[model samples]
Target: MAHHFSPIKFDNKGNIRESVFSILRNAILDKKLEPGQRLVERNIAEQLGISRTPVREAIHKLELERLVTHIPRKGVVVTGFTKADIIEILVIRTSLEALICSIAASKIRPRELDRLELLAKQISDEHGKGNLKKSNQLNNKFHEIIYKTAESPRLYDFLNTLHEYITKFTEVAYSKPGRSEEVWLEHNEIIAALRNRDSLGAESAAKRHTENSSKAFLEMAF
Candidate 1:
C-alpha cells in the first residue's frame, strides 16, 4: 500500500521526476506493485492525476535504472529478476557494503553513531508492533546513514541500486519467522563496530551481515 504522505508537497512541479521516482520506487520496493507488471504511461498519469509527459520521462529514467524495460511495440514493463540477476546483485552489494563500512568506520562521528543507535531501537519497536513497513523504512534509513558517511557519490549510487534489488529479499525476511530478531542482533553488532572506530571490525561485520542475507535470499527466493 502507498503510505499517504502527510504534509504532501505538490507545489513544485519541477520536482516531478523526484516525486514520480520516489512513488514508483516505493511501490516496487514495498511490493505494492509486483515485478513484471506492465507500466502503462496513460494509466500511471491518470492514477497520479498528472499529465503523461512526466510519466513518460519517469519511465525513461526507470529504464535507465534497469527497473523497467521499453519493449518494441509493447511499451514499458517492470523488470523481473532471474537467479543470475539475484547472484549478480548480491555479490556486488557484498563488495560495496564492505567498502562503505571501511570508510564509515574511520570517519563516523559520535553524533551520527548516536543517531544510528536510535534508529536500531526504533526498528526493533516497529517490528514488535507488527508494523513491517515502518520497520523497513527505519532499517533502510539506518544503513543509509552509514552509506552517506562514506562520502563517495558513485559508491552511494551503486549501493542504492543494490539496495533496491535486495529489498525484496529483506522484506520477505522481515515478515517471516524469527528473522527480525536475528537481523536486529547483527545490526547491533555493526553499530557497535562503527562506534569503536574499528575498521576491520566494521568490514567484517558488514560482510557477515550481507552474507547472511545473501544466503537467506538465495535459499528462500529460489
Candidate 2:
C-alpha cells in the first residue's frame, strides 16, 4: 500500500475528493457525521462537485481506517458502533494516552506547558460559550500538545489514528451530559501534573481522564 502525496491542486481530481475527505473526517471527528449514515457517492459527488474517481479513492482510504464500510456494491455507510466498539476504543486510548503522558512529563518544557495552558484556556472558554466546534478543536489541541511532547514519530502516527476514532464518539458522549466542565477540569489536572514534572501523577491522571470519558460515553450510550 504505497502512495504518494501528489499535492492536490484545485483542478486535480483528488482536490474535491481530498476536500470532501477532510470535511467529512472533521465532521465525524466533530460528531457532525452521525453514526450509521449512508454515504452515497453520487449524492456526495454532486454535493462537492467532484468526479467519482477521487471520491472512490477517498472511500477506499476511509475503509482502511474502518471509518466507512462498503457492502457488495450497495455503496457505503459510516460504521456504527456497538457497546463493544466503544469499550475497546476507550481501553486502548486510555493505555496509549497514559503512556504518552508519562513520557511527556519527563520531557515537557516550561514553554510547552505555557502552550498547553493557552490551549486549555481556549477550550475552557469555548466550553463556557457552548461553541462545540471550537471547544473540540481546543480539546484536540490540548492532547496534541501532550502527544507532540512525547517526541516519538511512530507513536504519534499510531496515536493519530486512535485519536480519530475517539474524537467523535467522545464528543457525542460528553456533549449531551453537560460534561465539558469536567472534561476541562481533568485536562487542567493533567497539565498541573506535567508542570510539576510528576511522571507518575501525570500517567495516573491521564488514565483516569480517559477512563472517565469512556465511562461517561458508555453511560450516555446505554
Evaluated with TM-score, which candidate comes out highest?
A: 1
Task: Give the TM-score (vs. native) of candidate 2.
Answer: 0.74
Please, what's the RMSD in Å of model 1? 4.1
Angstrom error at residue 191, model 2 = 1.5
How does residue 216 of candidate 1 score in lDDT? 71
Number of clashes found in candidate 1: 0
Error of 1 at 90 (Å): 2.5
Which stretch of 10 consecutive residues in model 2 shows the poorest summed lDDT? 1-10
Cα-based TM-score, every candidate:
0.78, 0.74
Q: Candidate 1: what lDDT?
A: 0.79
Model 2 C-alpha lDDT per residue in residues 3-40, reported as the tens digit of each score:
11233456654456656676666655545666677677
lDDT of 2: 0.77
Q: Candidate 2, 181: how far from true, in Å?
A: 4.0
lDDT of each: 0.79, 0.77
Candidate 1 C-alpha lDDT tens digits along 77-103 = 788446786688788889899889988
